[model samples]
Target chain A: MKSLSLKRLLVTSALLLWSLTSLASSQFTGPSRDANGNVVPTPKGEQCVEPTADMRANHMKYLLHKRDLTMYDGIRTKQHSIVACIDCHATPNEDGKIVRIHDDSNQHFCASCHAVASVKLDCFECHADRPVEAFSDADYDPVQQLDEALAHSDKPHALMNRKVQ
Target chain B: MSHLDQETDMKNTAKSSAPNKIDQYRRRFLGGSVAAVAGVAIAPGVFLQTVNAKPADQEVTANNRWGLLIDTTKCASGCSDCVSACNKEHGLREIHGPETDAQWIRKVTLKNKSTGHTINLPMMCQHCEKPPCVDVCPTGASFRRVDGIVLVDKHICIGCRYCMMACPYKARSFIHETLTDQLPHAPRGKGTVESCTLCVHKVDRGDGNTACAEACSHGAILFGDLNDRSSEISRRLATTGGRELRAELGLNLGVRYQGL
Candidate 1:
């Protein structure tokens, strides 16, 4: 009787440990991996204006604030522009063409994060999810070009990795 | 002096001091304002901080009332450049027939029945100060900007089409089908009402010109700040005294026709 009870306790402990491990692994899964186990390439930028952890937590707030400024004040500075985000985070498809945020087959940066968070984003319903066709020629290295263009524009930022004023 | 004489003297002194007190307050107010101005001049950043700290995020202001002066005499009968330009600017492609497709602006030809005189002019959202569309909106989706430009807030629009019915010019159009390849500047969605924003995205970007006005090779459209008495539109209106379509309505339309 004692041996059987001990065996039952061991089994319960093993089950609990297994379940906890799986939960932790699932929770810690990186965003660069897709559902099909494909490792999508991480988007390139020297550094985000804010730290990665800060951005992960407060990106939405920053976007909302910047959107109001751009919409109301006509302040189209590249620091927090949604167009700039699309330019930087757009991913290529199987055909090596840039995919938009609304594409079901492939997930772009915003869609990927939004899917993971299970958040509904209505922006692409009206606004174009992809960097416009005007920038298609420079799609090869768009992030750098966009950063450079914004840096050289009339409302220039300080530089890469600097705080956006 | 006796006690009555002393009381009277005190009353007189009090009367004299009242004006002095008011002058002191006025002096302090002026001094504080002057100091503020001096501080703004010295740093200049203080002024920027104040501008940034403004609670209301007003992108458009009433200081510049944008208006269009259309000289119908200059408009070619068959030319549709302004319409085409507006369509291209707003990404208003026709997925459906003319009955369903969105028309932000259209060229209308009117004939006088008695004289048989015909005139061709482009008709769009008159952008009236007293827009009937704005009045009938149940959801307050139709709103005018501080700058006197009226727009439909598509995000909140319920697709009721009440605004369409209320508009006198038949300007607003309802999107029937899903749209693709939409311009980044203009975001049109299905089941929402849209109209000519006067190329508001371009205007907000400080372009100070509308697509229709720019596309008019015949120089029929003149876009300017109507509030400025010296502006080109104001000067032209002063000379020609352009007629507002349906002037009896007292809508005070921003767009005026010179040769209607």
Candidate 2:
């Protein structure tokens, strides 16, 4: 009887330990890896302009303020500019192609976290998702270039034609 | 003392202070000339290098009133290079017919019925001093910048098209279809009113000229500060003169036309 009770205690503790370990590990699992278990591309910058925690909390505030300054006041300083953010964060993949922010794969830096957080990103609907260098040629016609890019993309028309709400 | 002696003494005192006053005036004149000469010598180099570029950190102020002088004689009747350049620069595409498509600038040919004389001109947003669009906008989306450039704040524009009805030039266009892959400098989304920004991005970049102005092969367009007396546009307007379209409306348009 004593042996059986000791065995039951050990089993209970083992189960509890296993469950606690699983929960802790899941907490650490970030959006760094995609559903296919591929490592997501990181930002090109060595470090963000602000500390990571601070940026995560107050990036929208900075963007909103800077946008107003740039739009109305014509203050085009690079600090906290959306163009600077896209140039650093939206990096090319192994295939040497940068993904659009609204891509369903959710591999793009902004989209990955946004997808997980269930936040709808409307900025990319009007703004360029990639740097100018990502385009094939400097003087290429934008309409033709976009058409060719869409043709090569897997979900061509559907992605480009998605209505903005 | 005798009266004559007293008067002479007073004259002597006046004579004594006269040279000192002259010397003070001379010093002031010399200092002013030196500063003026320095400004003249150094200004051209700085102006030529960075033509009308405001500092990136500084806010655009009312000190600079940007204006454009278009020579109608230089603009060809069939030529649409300016329009094409504007479209390319702003990433404007023709997804629909002329009725629905966005056009920032269009060529209008005017003919005198009695004289049989014809004139070709490129017409765009006048960028009025007191913009009717700004006044009629219920959402405060249509606004004029401090530097005299009129712009539609797309974020606040609710696609009401009130500005379109208010504008005398028919300058504003409302986007009806969904758009993607817009240029970084120019952000256009559906359900927003947009018009000729006068290349505000380039203006902000200190490029000194709009894409349309740069692409004009005949040099019909002269863009410069209307406030600056020495600017080519202002000097030419002062000498040769330019007329505002619909002058009776009294909008005081930034864009002026010559040979119309």
- How accurate locally, in lDDT, is each candidate? 0.70, 0.78
Docking class of 1: incorrect
The best candidate by TM-score is 2
Model 1 regions more than 4 Å off: A1-31, A34-44, A64-76, A91-95, A133-165, B1-58
lDDT (10s digit) by residue, model 2, range B1-260: 43335336545632333364366457656765875687589866443222498889987766578989999989887888888789888888766556777889888899999999999888899999999999999988899987899999887889999999999999999899998768888989999999999999999888888888998998998888887777889899999999999999999999999997
Candidate 2 lDDT, A82-117, residue by residue in tens: 988988888887677788887777778777666654
Q: How much is the lDDT of residue B82 in candidate 2?
A: 87
Top candidate when judged by lDDT against the true structure? 2
TM-score of each: 0.69, 0.76
Q: Flag regions of model 2 displaced more than 4 Å.
A: A1-31, A34-39, A137-165, B1-51
Q: After superposition, how far is residue B65 of candidate 1 from its true place, in Å?
A: 0.5
